[model samples]
Target: MPKVTEAYRRKKQLEIAHAAKKVFETKGYTDTSMNDIMLEANIARGTLYSYFDSIEQVFLEVLAIVDNHSFTFIEEVCNMKFVDQLNTLIYKEVVDLLRQPSLVQARAEYFFSLEDTTFFEQRHKRVIEGITNFLQQGVESGEFAPQKDVRSIAHFMLSFVDGLMLNTSQLGETSNFVYDQLEVFHSSLYYLLGVEN
Candidate 1:
């Protein structure tokens, strides 16, 4: 048998994960099954299991991809002005959620119904830490007021984005009115951060 290189393994795993994401998004976490993913991936059952032990693991991989993508997007915007970072984050989130409501709904289902809360907690913690670090840097640089509680602000921002995404998922395709509301809501957050809008 040919030796499977590490890069090849990772590529196969990502391919399976991408297919699993489509299945989960269409059928949701509860309704999705390993067989469904196998079919979606066009891989045999053994091949699928060789990559992921179970459907939940595949779902987690998909979540990780989404998280990594979001974090990278935020990180890239870190060099921008503080207000620009906040606005860009908010706008990107709304636009992404609107473009991929299925993924957002799958994430909501995972958060609300998954048996293991550890994953959810850890993901949120990392997001909070990232936001806190960014805000702290901004404070040190005099881009933001020093009086704000970085941790609290991070928590609130996460909650705000989650709530907005959850609502947008439930409402299906977002309307202009919803976008308007998000603008107003983001303005309030900007005010809370002492960013002159």
Candidate 2:
């Protein structure tokens, strides 16, 4: 009985957090209030408090949700044929931005208001490490071109996706051109990698 009660409470808490996320996205951080979140969640003020200590904490949870989803997609791509895996990873990252990806906006607001975080270091290391290991395998198998500087290429490849997102932000809807650009980037990577044409 107690176990069921706790499970129900947790489910209710996630629902409240999801509602607050929608409100925060539309309202903007400075413009949003705890009352607004409570109203959005359709929960009593005390019920809201039972889930989150503060509005900022709720915002962090939303960003964490976006980060986690993106990483899960990334993990799924990591095991494919080298070229397919790389292309999928790059294409998915761009598609995220093209869809007005949540993490990009959340990150901007966070940096404008908050302190540096260990989350940044750990998440970045995990992403780069996975890509590096896959590329290293391709080189060993003679399936991809051997680069004298595997680490450098890994860094640049990661930067390329980030750079595309940054550029997409500046260009807005006009950035639809990035889909074509990404294809060219992938094709060049394949050719340079000495993968079968």
Candidate 3:
């Protein structure tokens, strides 16, 4: 295939992924059929099959698209020379999650349903490891306050992120964090990390 034609193929695949995301979100993964995606993408059956042989293939790709840069974002930010800077990066990440709300929650829903499968289970484990490593380094460097079990704090931080994502997604409204609400979360986190108020 010509170079230009090959590029178009990649672009078309991404478009298909976006279409699949909408269908999967509206109709739940188990209820979504390949034909639903074909209709949503407005492509012929053969064309859809050319891109993805199975609905699961398309579902996985959609998951990939949604989570494309999140882990990389965390890893790159964690490499900052200062652990404090890394926390700043994490704070921004949490804020972005707050702003979009649904993006992360949708991903979580898809992930839990797929957990029994090796592919999903391995990816989840990898995420936990990546997060744990970052938190461990932060504690060692005094960026985060150490609990006897820093690992629990790390897990809770991730769970907090997940909980907030689910709430925001379920609300499906603008982030409602008021000035007082923001202050409470910030104050609690500061106390947890031993940062001066």
Reference-based lDDT, residue 5, model 2: 82
lDDT of 1: 0.80
User: lDDT at 115 for candidate 1?
Assistant: 84
Candidate 1, residues 17-109, lDDT tens digits: the string is 999989888888888999999999999999999999987789989988877887788778777987778777777765766667367667767
The predicted structure with the larger lDDT, 2 or 3, is 2
Question: Whose TM-score is higher: candidate 2's or candidate 3's?
Answer: 2
Report how far off residue 87 is in candidate 3 (Å).
5.3
Tens-digit per-residue lDDT, 101-170, candidate 3: 2445445556677747788777666667766787677667776775345566556666666666676666
| Best prediction by lDDT | 1
Q: Can you rank all candidates by TM-score, best first?
A: 1, 2, 3
Instruction: Evaluate residue 44 in candidate 3 and report its C-alpha lDDT on the 0 to 100 scale.
Output: 99
Q: Top TM-score: which candidate number?
A: 1
Per-residue lDDT over 77-167 for candidate 2, one digit per residue giving the tens place of the 0 to 100 score: 6567766766676677657655663444545565566566676667667668866777788888677884346666667677877667656
